[model samples]
Target: MLKEERYSVILDLINKKGILKVSDITDVIDVTEVTVRRDLQDLDQRGLLKRIHGGAQSTHPIKLEKELSHIEKKNLNLDSKIHIAKKIATTICDGDSIFLGPGTTIELVHDYLNVNNVKIVTNSIHVFNGFIDDPRYELILIGGSYRNKTGAFVGSIANDILSRINIDKAFIGVNAINDNTITNSNEDEGMIQTTILNNALEKYIVADSSKLNKRDFYQFYTLDKVTAIITDNNISPENIDKYSKYTKLYF
Candidate 1:
C-alpha cells in the first residue's frame, strides 16, 4: 500500500481506539513492525498523535472528572512508577520533615525510602499506613472527611491543619499536567495539595509519562510553582523539551 493509504488507516484506528500498538497496526494493514513504527514517528512529528513506548496515543487532552480508585490506579504504570519512586527516594535525607500527598505513584515511594529520623505528614491513609510501624520515622495523619475512592482525607479540617505546619519538602501527585497547569479531579484535594506545597521549603510533583499533556477537572497549581517534576524516562524527547522550558524535570 502507498504511505498515504497507510497513514489514513493508522489514523483511523488511533482516532477510534485512542491508542494503538505497532502490532495492532501491523495486523490490520499488513505492514512490517518497522514500517508501522516509521509511520507513527512521522505522525508524531506532525503532531497528529503521540508516540509512546510501544504505541501511539491521541494527542488530545484527557479531561477526567472523576479519578480512578486507589486499587485501579496502582497497576496502570507499575514499572514507570517504580522507577520514579526510586529516584524520588534518593532526594530525602535523615532528620528531614516531609509531606507526602495521595496517589498510587507517591505511595510507591515508601517502599524505597531508606532514610532515618524523618518526620512524615500526610492526609493519605495509605501513606500513613506505610510508615506507621517504622521505628525511624514519625508519622502524622491529617484527619478530615475521608474519600473512599482515593483513600485520602480532604476537607476544611485537613486544609486547616496543613496550613499551620511548615515542612522541608513536599511530594505531591496530580491527576494531570496540561500546558502550564497542574490539576486534580477533586477541588478539595487540589486545595489541600496547594496548601502543602505553598508551605514547604521545596516542592516536587510526582507523575508518570502518561500524565503529561493531560487535563483534569480542577486546576490547583502551575508548573512554575514546583521545584521540579519527577517522571519516568519514557517521556518523549519532544515533551521533555517542551515541558522543561517551564520547570526542571528529573527522569
Candidate 2:
C-alpha cells in the first residue's frame, strides 16, 4: 500500500491499543522497519505520542471506571450484543448444566434461553430472577453478599459455592479483551467471575464486538483462559486473528 495509508493505520492502532511498539506498528502497517520508525517519529514530533523505549504511548490515556451505568452497557451495542447472546444460547442443548455470569449479554442469553431442563447456577440476582421462578428451568442462586448495582453476589460465600459446583459451559461476560487478556470493569466482579470459570468444563465469553481488543482494568482471564468467544462480526480482523491462536472464535 501507500506510505500515507500506512501512517493512517498507525494512528488507528494507537487509538485502539493506546500504545504501539515500533516493531508492532511495522507488522501492522506492512511497511519496512525504517519506514515505520520514521512514521512514528513524525507522529511523536507532532505531540501525538510520548516515545517509550520500544513503543509510543498515546497522549490520550485510556481510563476505566469501576462502574459503568446500566444504560451505558445496555446501549453499547444493542443489536450486536443481541446477536452474540443468541449465538451463545444456540451452543447449548437440553439438560446441560450451565453457569451464567452477571452482565447484560448473559442476561440476554438467559432471556433468550428456551432450552429445557438446563440447571443454571449463578450468583447474578438478575439471572436468578429471570429464570428462578420459571418451572421450565432450575435456578441455583449461590448465597453471598449482594452487589445492588450489578446485582451479583460478591465475597467469600460466592467463591465457596462456586468451588462446589461443576458446570458444562459458562456464559461469561467481559469488560474488554486486549493485550491478550480478558478484563472486567469491576474488581469484585472479576473476583467472582474468576471462581466461576475455574469450575466450568467449557467457557464462553459473550461480549459485544465493541469490547473486543479493548483492554480495561481488572483482568479476570487471558486469551487462553476460555475455550471460545461468542461475539458479533464487528470485531477487527487483526484482533480475531490475534485471539484465534488461543481460542475458537465464533460470531
Candidate 3:
C-alpha cells in the first residue's frame, strides 16, 4: 500500500475504534511493525492521534464508551488497581456499612479490607462472591437484571433495594471522569450506582489513572457530589491539578 493509503486507513481505524494497537492496524493494512510504528509517530507529531505505548488512540477529547467484559478488564492495569484498592480499604472503618460497586478494582478492595463486622452491599455477582466465603463481612447482594458482561445487576429492582439501604460509605467504579462529570457505558448500571451514591453518607469514586479525563455515554453523577475520588498514583501532575479544582483526590 502507498504511504498516503496507509495513513488514511490508520486514521479511519483509530477514529472508529478510538484506540488501536499496532497489531490492529497491521491486521487491516498490510505492513510491518516498524512501518506501523513510523506511521503512528508521524500521526502523533501531526496531532492526528495520540501515540501511546504499543498503540495509538484518537485525539478526540471525549470518545464514546466501550464496554469490556469483566474478564477482559481484570488484567488491564492490574498494578494500579491493586494500589488503589489497598488505599480504599484503609478508609473503611469497622462496623461501617459500605456499598461496593462493580468493577475489577472494586473486587480487589474486598481482599484488602481488614475491618471487622462491616456490612458489604453490592450489585455485582463478582464482588459478592469475593466476600461471601468470609465471615468478616455482612454481605448483601442486590439482584435485578444481570449484565453478564460486567457481572452487575441493574434495572429497577436493584434501584429499589438501594433506596432502602442506609450506607455509611459508597465506593463506586466508573468508566470515565472528565472535569466534574462521572460517566458509565450502561444506563441501567449507572442509574443503580447513582442511587447508591445518593443514599450513602459518604460517596467515593474508585478508578485508575486511565479513567481520568475521559467521557462515557451515560453521565450518571459528578465529582462535586462525591466525598473524593480514589485513583492510583500514576496520574499525571497536570491531571491532578485539573481534577483537584473540581473535587478532592486520593492517590
Clashes of each: 0, 0, 0
Candidate 1 clashing pairs, residues 3+ apart or interchain = none
lDDT of 1 at 197: 96
TM-score-best of 1 and 3? 3
Who wins the lDDT comparison? 3
Off by over 4 Å in 2: 1-61
lDDT string for model 1 (95-138, tens) is 99999999888888889999999999999999988888888899
Q: Report the C-alpha lDDT of model 2 over 135-159, residue by residue, as the tens digit.
A: 9788888878888777788888788
Evaluate residue 190 in candidate 1 and report its C-alpha lDDT on the 0 to 100 scale. 93
**TM-scores for candidates 1 onward, in order:** 0.75, 0.75, 0.76
lDDT (C-alpha, whole model) for all candidates: 0.90, 0.80, 0.91
**TM accuracy, model 2:** 0.75
Candidate 3 residue pairs in backbone clash = none
lDDT of 1 at 162: 96
Backbone clash pairs in model 2 (N, Cα, C under 3 Å; residues 3+ apart or in different chains), count: 0
Per-residue CA lDDT of candidate 3, range 57-156, in tens?
A: 9987456669899989999999999999999999999999999999999999877888899999999999999999999888989999999999999999
**C-alpha RMSD (angstroms) for model 3:** 11.3
- In terms of lDDT, model 1 sits at 0.90
Worst 10 residues of 1 by lDDT: 58-67
